[model samples]
Target chain A: MEKIIVCIKGVPKPGSIKVDPETHTLKRENMELILNPNDRPALEMALRLKNTYNTEVVVISMGPPNVIPLLKYIYALGADQIILLSDRAFAGSDTLATSYVLAKAIEKLSPFSLVLMGLKSIDGETAQVPPETASLLGIPSLTNVKDLFMERGKWIAIREMDYGEEEIEVTPPIVASVSPLAFDYIRPPSLKRLLEVKTKEPLICQVKDLNLDPQRLGLQGSPTQVIEVFEKKIETKGLVLEGSPEELVEKLIEILKDKGLIKF
Target chain B: MFEKIKLEDLSKENILAYGEFYKGELNSSSLEILSPLKEIAQTLNKKLILVSLIGSLENIKDWEEIKKSLADEVWFVINEELKDFREDLYTEVLVKIVKFSQPYGFFFPATKIGMSLAPRVAGALQVGLCAHVNNLEVKDNQIIMARPTYGENIIAKLISKSIPIMATISLGAFGIKYGEKEPSIKEIIFPEDFVWKSKLKIRRFAPSKKKPTKLSTAKVIVAGGRGLKNKETFQKLFELANLLGAEVGATRPVCYEGWVEEERMIGISGVTVRPKVYIGFGISGALQHTVGMENSEFIIAVNTDKEAPLVKIANLALIGDAGKILELLLKNLSK
Candidate 1:
């Protein structure tokens, strides 16, 4: 049977993120954690493939111990097995460092035919890890994948290219970063399946377990650094126009002219 | 005292061209990218270059004007054989120019083309890239690129240690600024050896029957959200927009609830808008929905929720139901 790995991230719940007053850093304490919204589509895609092609879906994540609940949630969605790659050594890693650890994990879980991931994580929006991970593994990668189908043992996928859709066919061992738009089509887990998998324990692995280069798996491994961050304060209050229909149209034209957005 | 830096001073300066469509016209995001390119070029005293791989540069009417407006020189890799965008061909051209030019940084718009090309370009160059950047600045001799991460909730600043640092700017993040001094445009033709991979084939281009009404580029926008409660109430928002000659927009909830189409949603996931007058009706101003239009010149929010973040950001916060306030505003304006 073909094996597929879907990468998932545990992120702060929507509207629950808080910023520290003094440090301006994200305050994680007391925040509700859930699977990243984008990752849901990847998991859904993997589940669909598993149902159709008789495949095994493995959900993988790298985060703190608190992320196990998220793995359990993925299991509820029909993931056959779960891999939690957690360790203090992997903390504070940027996209580059994080991809390093995940690539090593993928290498450790070799013989897999496909890897699926969200185009980006809600927490990091860098959208770098998927392609970076693919590069590290020396495999062909596709991103912004909207549709996927299988024919004659090869995956036919529709990807959003620069201007429009480009359909490509690739054999297994390919990596894909799915877009968030695809999640709306996914079917939620049935209550029976949820209850059945709710009690299952996830398989946990650490950096040492993957046998990754200790120097290249965390903060010290990250080449890029965030020097400082400050909230942007808007200085311009802006122009307001109010009046009748014709008058408002005239006023809008004048403003656009002044701003050079248009010319008369 | 400010140090005098020469145009040849290649210490730590770079230009990123948000990938534009090869066929129809130059992407509007290119203009937005040029706004910062002008500022960065002046600050860093480095040459600005714009690169595009297209069927024919002759077809682009604004080619000369755009070249003169932004880059000190314009480079085009024209390939009739490469009319449509192929990842391999485009990536090959980008890698060649980046390696030869040796720029300190690169920029691409956070569009479909940009998101695809950026990571591959960075991978080919083996350097760090920051995607979907909202702000870019030169700080302490390093390019500080800020992008909203964590679902547009918190900003992440990334600094590259290697040269040719790449980033893709989110639409509507930076307003367009036209420089007083025009640029001198120079064009470089691509050599014949440009590689083309025909792995993907374009069947045809079926143009949209309804031309995309340029709502995001409108000077005035009147938007409604799920707070409107019903389709009948949502119609009044459009009536007001029509009366004001403004485009109609909706929040994610409005679109999700099927009150409006996805094209009308205004937010991080939707189109980014910077109208002159942005009036929000029955919208709670969620961050995902607000960031797209927060840069509007004048924001007037009407919502029952006094504590909504939209109300806090609005210049005029009317404390009442959207339907009631809109009716009163309409009647008052009719006089």
Candidate 2:
């Protein structure tokens, strides 16, 4: 059976992220870890394909071992397999090195008909991994993918352009990133099936097992370096307009008219 | 006395700026980055070079006009296959350009296309890349780029620590500046041996709605946010917007609530607009959202909470109920 790989990440639950007042660094401790919210649609897309076509869905994440629970969360939704690409050596990898490690893992699990991922992770918030991974794997990729369907052995992707949407088709072994626009289409997971999802121990892969160049496996392979992180000092002009609702509207428009924003 | 920078910085080449022109001219977002990138180039005594990709050779004629009017030298990438943005193909072309040029510094607009392509280019070349970068400082020959991260709450300063320093500059972050006359243009034919395993074929496009609001170019914009409790009150914003000939916009939450169409939402997840006048009702001015419209010529915000962050940067902060103010505005304007 063909396999669909969903590259996922563990993100700090919203309202759970706390910043250290002094260092301005994110304090991940004591935060509830959840599946990156945006990745849900990609997971749903994978499940939808499985329901239509007889395919196995594998959800993969790379973080600390604590990330395993987030993968189990995917199993509860219907993923067939899970893998955690974790190791001390893989820590502090930037987007480029992160994509490199992910590409290697995807290559090891070769014969994937499609690789689905979220456009941007909430924490990292960069949509580069999907294409970077495709580049490393020698395949075509698309970003901002909102809709996908199979036709004549090719995947038709509905991508959200800046002004309009465009439909594109390409034979898989392709990588496609899901846009936030796809969130509305995700179906609810069944509670009963979620309970029955026998959680299996996720297979783990280390840097050595992937046979990656030792020099390029972690921080050393990453290019970007953070010099300092500090709180942004916002200088706000304390200007307040005093009036009733109607008076405020009238006065505001009068001022805007002065700025040539309104006429007559 | 100010002495010249450290010896290591002296050997760096000219600054290469990457962007494209739309409808015969560079877009406002591209110009915004070019202006600031140009400033940096001058500070470092380096020439500013703009490299753009054109789908056809004919587009170069349009580019020639842009060169004469502003900027230093312009480089054009004429590739038939590269007309449309295919991530794999664009990455391939960009990677090759970076290799051949070997620019010491680079700038790309942080549009959807740039955000998608910059990281891959940075990955391919093994260089550092900062996203939505707004500030740059060079000290001791080291370039430091700073950008708002963690939902715009914290600022992170990044250094390339490698050969080519790169950043994807956010739109509306800087002002555009013009350079001397006698602009130069150079053309490079795309590499033929470029490799993409398979091609992504464009089948069709969703019918364009030609939204009447046209938020980006709208002279006046009245945007609603989570302060809109009901769809009825949300409609009041539209009524007010129509009366003033303003475009109707909303924050992400308003769109999620189905109060407004997704395309009408303004923020990081939506569109970035710079209208002459912006009236935001109930917006707290989150960095993600403000990054979209902060460049508006003037801003007036109405929110009951005086302590809301949105009130801070607003030119005129009216402490009141958003819905009430919007309704009154519509009532007065309709008169």
Most TM-score-accurate candidate? 2
Q: Write the per-residue lDDT of candidate 2 for residues A1-264, one digit (tens) a residue.
A: 469999998877755666665544455545677888778889998998898988999989887787887887788788889899998877667677888899999998889989999987877676777877877787887788888888888888998765478899888889889976685666765686567655467899898788888777666777776668876455667478767887788887788679775577
**lDDT (C-alpha, whole model) for all candidates:** 0.71, 0.75
Listed per prediction, chain B TM-scores read: 0.84, 0.83
lDDT of 1 by residue, A1-264 (tens): 468999998887777776655434455545788888778888898998899889899889988778888888788888889989988788667676787788888888888978999977766667778877876676667788877877676777787654556677766677889966765677777677689876788899987689888877555766666656545443323333334444544443454356554444
Q: Which candidate ranks first by DockQ, i.e. highest? A: 2
Q: What is the DockQ of each candidate?
A: 0.25, 0.57
How do the predictions measure up, each by TM-score? Answer: 0.82, 0.88
Docking quality (DockQ) of candidate 2: 0.57
Q: Which ten-residue region of model 2 chain B has the weakest summed lDDT?
A: B1-10
Question: Which one wins on lDDT?
Answer: 2
Q: Please provide, for model 2 over B222-262, each residue's C-alpha lDDT reduced to its tens digit, 9 standing for 90 to 100.
A: 99888867888997887777677889989876776678777
Clash numbers, per candidate:
4, 0
Docking category of candidate 1: acceptable
